[model samples]
Each structure stands twice: as C-alpha cells, then as structure tokens.
Target: MTTSLTIAVKRIHDAAAASDGARFLVDRLWPRGVSREKAALAAWLKPLSPSDALRKRYHGETADSDEAWDAFRLDYFEELDAGGEEAKAALFTLDAAAKVGPVTLLYAAKSAERNNALALREWLERRTR
Candidate 1:
C-alpha cells in the first residue's frame, strides 16, 4: 500500500460533493431509502461487512453501552480476521482504490462512531502499516 493512501468514513445519506477518489458502500445490506442512483457507489462490498448474526447482536441499540460496544468491536474484528476469502477480496478492493488516493467507506448506521466502516478502516490501516 502507498503511504499516501487515505481512508474516510461517512454516512450514506450525506451528500457527496467530491469526486477525488473511490466511494464504496461497506454495509452488508443496502441502506434503507437510498436508491442505487443516489448512492453513486463504486462498489457495495458486503463481504467487508459484519455477518448478519453479529450485526443483529450489535445493532444501533447497543451504541449507548460501552461494554457491549467493546465486546461487539472485538467480535467484529475476529469476524474480519476469520472472514477468509471474503475479507481478502474486500481488502484487495480497498488496497486498489487506496493506491490512487483516498477511499471513502460509506455506511448507513445512524451512529457514525459505532459502525463497521470505522472498525474496517482501523483494521485496514493496521494492515497497511
């Protein structure tokens, strides 16, 4: 990976004002009320998202609980590690985009700080270093 690689996370509902680099939807399920045209996504990398069971277990309701969130974060990372080919494919896609410039990961979670995109960004950064 290039030292210049940059990763950013943003909500899907947010307006996209820039065309500086790749934009990908990192959620396993397509965001509600967002059309494909409006999304303007380069890719919808479901493989990069948390599994259904994990997502359900750590839904938006868990955000307020630090302990739950911590446990979710740990479990999520484990899933990413054990994700095998799926995780590898997503990482490859991210790496390819990052080589050129910034790669923005879009998610639908209401809590910006408690989403998989943030976790994925951290995991990717660690791998890049």
Candidate 2:
C-alpha cells in the first residue's frame, strides 16, 4: 500500500483526536459501554482480535510475551490464510485505499504496551513488504 498504515491502541475518543483520515477498528469484541454510533468507525475487523485462548492465557500481564506472540501469529494466520475470507475483506479496505488517505487501525484496549493491534501491525507490515 502506498499510503501509510498506523496501528494504535486507544479508546475511541483518543482515536478521534489522532486519526483524521480513514479509521478502522480492529477488535473482535466491541468495547463495553460503547455504542456503535459512538465508535465513529469506518470499518470494524473483528477477525483480527486475539483468540479466546490467547486472551485467556494472557489476560493481563504474563511472563511469556514471545510465546504469546507466536501463538497470536498462528491464530492470525488462520484468520489471514485459512478461513480468513473476512480477514481479507478487512485488510482489503486498507489495501484498496492506499493512495487516497491515511489509514489508521484503531484498537479499543487498555494495554497499549502489548496487544493484538501491535501484532497485527507487525504481521501486516511483514506480509506487505
């Protein structure tokens, strides 16, 4: 994609302030206490979220960041390669709009340190390159 893709962890409000062009939501589950209209999302990619197992395993903080990342990649591959039809559709929006505007992946999560959005950004970068 010619246009840059920004993946950031933020609440919808923070995303609003930071993202001025195109905004895409990348969470499997919608944030609690948030309405669909309030999300102000251009697109939502639920398939990109961490799997249930991974979430449960690394609910908050954990010792195995590397292992969690590896498992996350495996799960992401399943979303991108195997039964990833929806995943393709989600990513395709960004790919298709490469030249028109900035693309930001908005994630509604508390932990900005480590999460699915970061993993997704890396994975997308590696594959796109």
Q: For model 1, name the residue pairs that clash.
A: none
For candidate 1, the lDDT comes to 0.83
- Summarize candidate 2's per-residue lDDT along 71-110 as a digit string, tens digits: 7666665655554677667677767654566666767667
Give candidate 2's error at residue 17 in angstroms: 3.0
Best by lDDT: 1
Q: Candidate 1's residue-wise lDDT over 1-129, tens digit each?
A: 665678889999988757536889989998899999888887889998989998988874557698888888788889888888877887788888887778899999898778888988887777667
- Candidate 2 displacement at residue 30 in angstroms: 0.7
Which number leads on TM-score? 1
> Which residue runs does candidate 2 get wrong by more than 4 Å?
3-9, 13-15, 60-83
The weakest ten consecutive residues by lDDT in model 1 span: 14-23
